[model samples]
Target: MNGALLTTWRLWDKIYYRCTRLCYVDQQNNNIFRVVIKKYGGKPLRSEQEVVVSPGDYYVKLHIHNCQLAHRLAGMTGEMRLGLAALKEVKTSLPALAKFVAEHPNADKITGVVGTTILYRGAQPLGFFVRDIDSPLVRWYKTFFFKLILSLCHPEGVARIYQKSDKLVAKRVFMSKRDLLERYLDDQPQT
Candidate 1:
């Protein structure tokens, strides 16, 4: 409960002022320069002054940000998978988890995945979305495409404001999880 409250507060803070500063070595001038990247309402400021990072600096900052995002996403996905795995023993487990995975077979789906990862034994992991993934060509396509999307979202990546749809989807997922827990915990088995 307390943790959730704190996360909410921190998220509010992060979104309200999603600013990132990157320090780069200006090769020509041999001087260190700072680039301020601000994402307002999940949109990067387009004005010249707003985006000062050079091509090299842009990559540097983007790479760093992307690395951070990947690490965080992996940690979260693993934790969610393990945590939900643990909950399997609970007789009243979440069923939506299985469906959610079916709809989104990739890690990003689960990581963007703000909802929950429930346990399931009666179903499979990779849904139709990634069932045949046998040939190298197909596999490469899937991997690279997901990575590209992740990169685009990296600079903003929840650090900035969320769109209305994003917020609603997240809320729906959370409510479903909450309802599942409540129903299972409180519902009396039909006698």
Candidate 2:
């Protein structure tokens, strides 16, 4: 999070956000996720709730703002503390995401939300269904990209990745529309 690094991150974030049209679920710089509505391209997936997401279905893809996350988590010590903080940030964003989907023009067409992450161990508890990436190429690409981001953002840097490589494999997480609404939305209508 040094001046130069921050500048690079800002530039990258700007480019990525524009190219992907990722909409912020909360305050621009402070939010943990940037999302885009996309058609599911991979094999069909079924959540624990028996919600089946098929190819060509429209869904929201959650993109973690890693640099922003790193900046927030910088200098935080201990795995437990970092994990808890990250989890808390995700929990906070759920309501906003629920609102976004509920208010979207294609709200009825959207089936659910999807995201890929290496940090998926705690996802099921949060109501996400974790699934292995079907394509080996995609799996490799995601793993490399996630680890690179981790190395760049983590306090321990490359050392942490080297030590924990095995546990860092990437996984896709799904939360169906029904699950998302049931978990994060209140009876009050979304504005």
Candidate 3:
């Protein structure tokens, strides 16, 4: 990743940590958190007042603020793809999911929400929606034509496309060995 992307990822990491801590610490009440990015001296990024983080001038520093209980819940509502088919089947094995996530640096950075939901009123499958459609596309094609096609397709087609795209994303995100273990664990029946 480029410096700008790395910085953004790091900032997101800090936000995730703060949000999780807030949620864990105060489970009783509603918690909200604001993530702010501002140039130095309250100037815009294009302004001279902005502080450049690197000599190469890839990134700028920004101000961040959080409430007592940061909104970790906001993080918990996005699409995630687990490599293990079995785990994908169960859908509720959070510990297994967490363990799978812990194996990767970026994956571990993710908290709150994991896993994509296949919308359905009952047994009949309905559709799937990308939770964070604006989120950075981890894959090349996902950012370009493929994602556009998937988005514009019919509901049933969209679901199929999501399934295929998720498999590719899961492979990219998870370690093969760890993912296999998770898949095995997912296959086992819950007690």
Highest lDDT scorer: 2
Ranking by lDDT: 2, 3, 1
Residue 53 CA displacement from its true place in model 2, Å:
1.1
Best by TM-score: 2
CA lDDT for candidate 2: 0.84
lDDT by residue for model 3 (9-85), tens: 45775677676522221123221212121112311112133221212321111111222212211222223321132
True-vs-predicted CA distance for residue 26, candidate 1, Å: 50
Q: Listing every candidate in turn, what is its Cα RMSD in Å to the true structure after a full C-alpha superposition? A: 20.9, 2.3, 19.1
Better of 1 and 2 by TM-score: 2
**Stretch of 10 with least lDDT, candidate 2:** 182-191
The TM-score between candidate 2 and the true structure equals 0.92
Where does candidate 2 stray beyond 4 Å? 187-191
TM per candidate? 0.19, 0.92, 0.19
Candidate 1: C-alpha RMSD after superposition: 20.9
Considering TM-score, where higher is better, how would the candidates rank from best to worst?
2, 3, 1
Clashing pairs for model 2 are none
The lDDT per prediction is 0.28, 0.84, 0.29
| lDDT for position 71 in model 2 | 79
Candidate 1 residue 147 C-alpha distance from true site, Å: 0.7
